[model samples]
Target chain A: MSSRNRIESVAHQTVQKSGLKNLSFRTLGAEVGVKSSSVHYHFPEKSDLGGALIQRYRQSLATTLAEIDDASPNAYDAIKLFSKLFTQECSEGKICFAGMLAAEVEFLNESNREGLQAIFNMYHTWLLDQLNQAGDELKIDLPTPTVAHLLLASLEGALLIDRAHPTNDRLSSVNILIDSWFGKIN
Target chain B: MSSRNRIESVAHQTVQKSGLKNLSFRTLGAEVGVKSSSVHYHFPEKSDLGGALIQRYRQSLATTLAEIDDASPNAYDAIKLFSKLFTQECSEGKICFAGMLAAEVEFLNESNREGLQAIFNMYHTWLLDQLNQAGDELKIDLPTPTVAHLLLASLEGALLIDRAHPTNDRLSSVNILIDSWFGKIN
Candidate 1:
C-alpha cells in the first residue's frame, strides 16, 4: 500500500476495534511506521482523516452494492446477498464503519456527517428498489418503503447486538425478517 | 446531589454524547467541577465508570418498563410507551449509552460486556412477554420472539439513525412497526 493508504488502513482498524473517538493520528502514524507529523502531512486535521475514511468506505460500499445487485438473478437473491454482507461483518467480531459512525454521529463534523448519512441513504435507495421489485416479482403486498427501512435498520442493529454478544446468536435477524416477508428463502 | 451521584450523571451525558472511549476522568471532573482525582476516587477505572453508567441505565429502564406496563391497558399501549422512550432520547439529539457501547464493543471489558448484554437480555425477555400477550389479546398470529427482536432492534437502530440525522426524521420507525402489527397505535 502507499503511505497514505497505509495510514488509513491502520486507522480504519483502530476505529473498528474501538471507535472514531479513540482514533489518533499519532497512533496510526506509529502503526504505519511514520512520524505523527508525517501522518498530519497527509491529512491536515483529525476530521480530515475521518472524512477521508468515510469517503473511502462509501466508495467501497457503493461498489459492493452495485456488484451484489448485478450478480443476483432476482430481488430475493439480491436481498439474501445484501443481508450476508452485514452478518459477515458481524461474524468477523467487528462493527462496520457505517455502524461505527452512526454510533458516534454526534462527534462527527459536517463532512463526516454527510459521508456517513450518504451511506445509509445509499442503503435506503438500494433496498427500496430491491423491495419494490420484490413486491412485483413475488406477487405479494410488500410495503416497499417501510419494509425497506425495517430490513436496513434491523440488519444494522443486529450488527451492534452481534458484536456485544456474538456467541449468543440463536436466531439471525435477517433470516427472521426475510422468512416473514417471503415465507423462507430456501 | 451527592458527589458520587453527580459524577455518574455527568459521566452518563459524556457517554451519550460520544462513545465510552471518549469518557475521561479529567473531563468528567472538569464538567462536574471537581478534580480528576476526585472522579478517579469515585470510579477508579474507565471500565468502572462504564459499568456504573450501564447499571444506572438498566435500572431506569426496568423502572420505566414496569411503569409503562402498569399504566397501559394492553400490549398496544405498552408498546407505544416503550417506543416513545427511545424516540424521545433521539429527539434530544443523543444516542442511548447502550448504542454507544455497542458501537465500541471491541473496547469493552467483561464487566461492561455483561452490563450491556444484560440490558439487551432484559429487553428481549420483556418484549417477548408483551408480544405473547398481544398475540392472545389481538387474536393475531405472531412469532413472539422474532417479532420482539425486530421491535427491539428496530427501535434501538432508529435511535442511532435518528442521532445521525435528527432533523431528517421523515418517518417514525416505531409507528411503522406498530402500524404493521396493530394497524396504528393512536
Candidate 2:
C-alpha cells in the first residue's frame, strides 16, 4: 500500500482499538513507519484524516452490502449478514468504527461530522431497500424506513451492550430477536 | 453540593460534552470554582472521577426506574419513560455519560471499567424485571434477558444514530419500534 493508504489503514485500526479521541497523527505515523510530518503531508489536519477515514469506510460498507445483496438468498439472510459484520468487529474487541465516532460526534469537526452522517444515511438507505425487497418477497408488512431504522439501531445498540458486558451473547440475541420479529409477521 | 459532589458533577458534564479524553482536572476545577489540587484531593485520578460519575449515574438511574415503576401503568409505559430519559439527554446535545464512556472502555482504568459495567448490568436487570412483569401481566412470552439486551442496545444505538443525523426522529422511532414489538405479543 502507498503511504496514504497505510496511514488510513493504521488509523482505522487505532480508532477501533481505542477511539477517535485517542487517534493522533504521531501514533499513526509510528504504526505506518512514517514521520508525523509525512502523515500530515497526506492529510493536513486530524479532521481531514477523519473525513477521509469515514469516506473510505462508506465505500467499504457499500462494497460489502453489494456483495451481501448478490450472495444472500433472502432478506433474513441479508440482515443476518449485516449483524455478523458488527459481531465480527466486537469479537475482535472493537466497536463499529462509525458507532465509536458517533459517540464522539459533538467533538468532531464539520468535515468529519458530514462524513459520519453520510455513512449512517447510506446504511439507513441500504437497509430500507433490503427491507422493502424482503417485505415484498415474503408477503409481509415490513414498515419500510421505520423498520429499517429499528434494525440499524438494534444492531448498533447490541454491539454497545456487548462491549460493556461481553458474555451476554448480544449479537446472537439480536439475530434471534430479529428472527422472532419476522416469525411474528409470517 | 459538597466539593466532591461538585467536582463529580462537573466532570460528568465535561465527559458528556467532549468525551472522557477531553475531560481534565483543571477544566473541571475551573467549572466548579476550585483549584486543580483541591479537585484531586476529592478524586485523585481521572478514573476515580469517572468511576464516581458512573456510580452517581447508576444511582440516578435507579431512582428514575423506581419512580417509573411507581408511576407507569404498565410495562409499555415504563419502557417509553425509560426511552424518554435518553431522548431528553440527546435533545440537550449530550449522549449518555455511560454510553460515551463505553466507547472508550479500553483506555479506562479498572475502576472506571467496573463502574461502567455495573451501570449497564443494572439497566439490564431492571429492564429484564420490567419485561418479565409485563409478560406476566399480558400473558406474553418474554425471552428473558435477550430482549432486555435488545431494548437497551436499540435505545443506545438510536441515540448514537440520532447524534449523527439530528434531523431524524430516532428517539420516537425507537419508542414506536419497541411499542410495536410489545403490540405483537399483545
Candidate 3:
C-alpha cells in the first residue's frame, strides 16, 4: 500500500478504538513505521487527517449500500446486510469511523465536522431510499424516514452499549433491533 | 448549594455538552467562579469528579425508576418515563453524562470506569425488570432483556444521531421506536 493509504488505515483503527481527538501525527508515525515528519508530509494538519478519514469512510459506505441494493430482494435483507457492517465492527471491539466521529463531534475541527455531517446525510438519504422502495409491499407501520433514523441511530448506539456494558450475548441489541423490524431472523 | 456541589453540577453539564476528557478543573473553575486550585480542593482529582458524577447520576436514576414504577401501570408507560430522561438531554444538545463517559471510556481513570459500568448495570437491571413484568400482558414479541437493551441503546444513539445529523424531525427515531413497541403513542 502507498504510505498515505497506510496512514489513513491506521488512523481509522485508532479512531475506532480510542477516538479522533487522541490521534496524533507522532503516534501515526510510530504505528505506520514512518517518521513523524513523513506523516506530516502527507497530511500537515490534524484536521486534514480527520477530513481524510471521514471522506474515505463516506465513499466506502456508499459503495457498500449500492452493493446491498444490487443483492437484497427487499428492505429486510437490505437492513440485515447493512447491520452486518455494524455487528462486524462491534465484535472487533471498535465502533465504526462515522460513529466514532459522531461520538466525538464536539471535539471536531470545522472541516472534520462538516465532513461528519455529510457522511450522516449520505447515510440517511440512502437508507431512506431503500426503506421507501420496500414500504408499500411491506406491512411496516412507521414512515420510511422514521425507520431509517431509528435504525441508524440505534445501531450507532449499539456500539457504545456493547463496548461499555457488554452483554453475555454482545449482539443482543443488534439482533433484537432486527427482530423488531421483521420478526426473528434466528 | 455547597460550593463543592456547585462545582459538580457545572462539571456535569460541561461533560454532557462536550465529554469527560475535556472537563478540566480550570474550565470548571471559570464556569463556577472559583480558582483552578479551588476546584481541585473540592475534588482533588479529575477522576474524583467523574466518579461523583456517575455516583450522583446512578442515585438519581434509581430514584426516577422507583417513581416510574409507582406511576406506570405497565412497561409501556415505564419505558416512556425512562425515555424522557434521554429526550430531555437531547433537546439541550447534550448527551447524558453516562453516554459522554461511555464514549470517552478509553481516556478514563479506573475508578471512573467502574463507576460507569455499575451505572449501566443498574440501568439495565431496572429496565429489564420493568419489561419482564409487562411481558405476558403486552403483545411485544421480543424477550425482556432484548427489549430493554434495544430501548436503552437506541435512545442513547438517538442523542448522537440527533446531534450529528440534526434531522428535520429530531424525535422521529424516538417516536418510531415507541411506535414499534406499542403502536403510535399519539
TM-score of chain B of each: 0.91, 0.89, 0.92
Residues B1-186 of candidate 2: C-alpha lDDT, one tens digit per residue: 898888877777778766776777887789899999998898878777777788889899889889988999898888788888756765566777777787777778877788888988888888888888885443334376777887788788888888788865566667766766567422
Q: What is the model-wide C-alpha lDDT for candidate 1?
A: 0.76
Ranking by DockQ: 2, 3, 1
Q: Enumerate clash totals for all models, in the order shown.
A: 0, 1, 0
DockQ of all models, two decimals each: 0.51, 0.67, 0.57
Distance (Å) between predicted and true CA of A159, model 2? Answer: 1.2
Residue lDDT tens for model 2, A13-119: 88876777778888789988989999989999888888888989999999998998899988888877887775676566678888888888777888888889898
The lDDT of each candidate is 0.76, 0.78, 0.77
Tens digit per residue, CA lDDT, model 3, A1-186: 999999999988899887888777898899999999998898888888888888898888889889988899988788788888656755555776787787778888778888888888887888888878875544557777887787777777777877776653435566666665675443
Q: What shift in Å separates residue B66 of candidate 1 from its native position after superposition?
A: 1.4
Writing each residue's lDDT as its tens digit, candidate 3 over B1-186 gives 988889888888888888878777887898889999998886788887888888898898788879888999877788787787657755565776787788878788878888898988888899889777875555566677777777777777778767776663535567566756775433
- Please provide, for model 1 over B1-186, each residue's C-alpha lDDT reduced to its tens digit, 9 standing for 90 to 100: 998999998778777777778777887899889999998888888888888889999999899888988998889888878887766755466676777788877788988899999998888898888878885554324467777777777776767776675643423744666765775532
After best superposition, candidate 3 residue A18: deviation in angstroms? 1.7
Highest DockQ against the true fold, candidate: 2
TM-score of chain A of each: 0.90, 0.90, 0.91
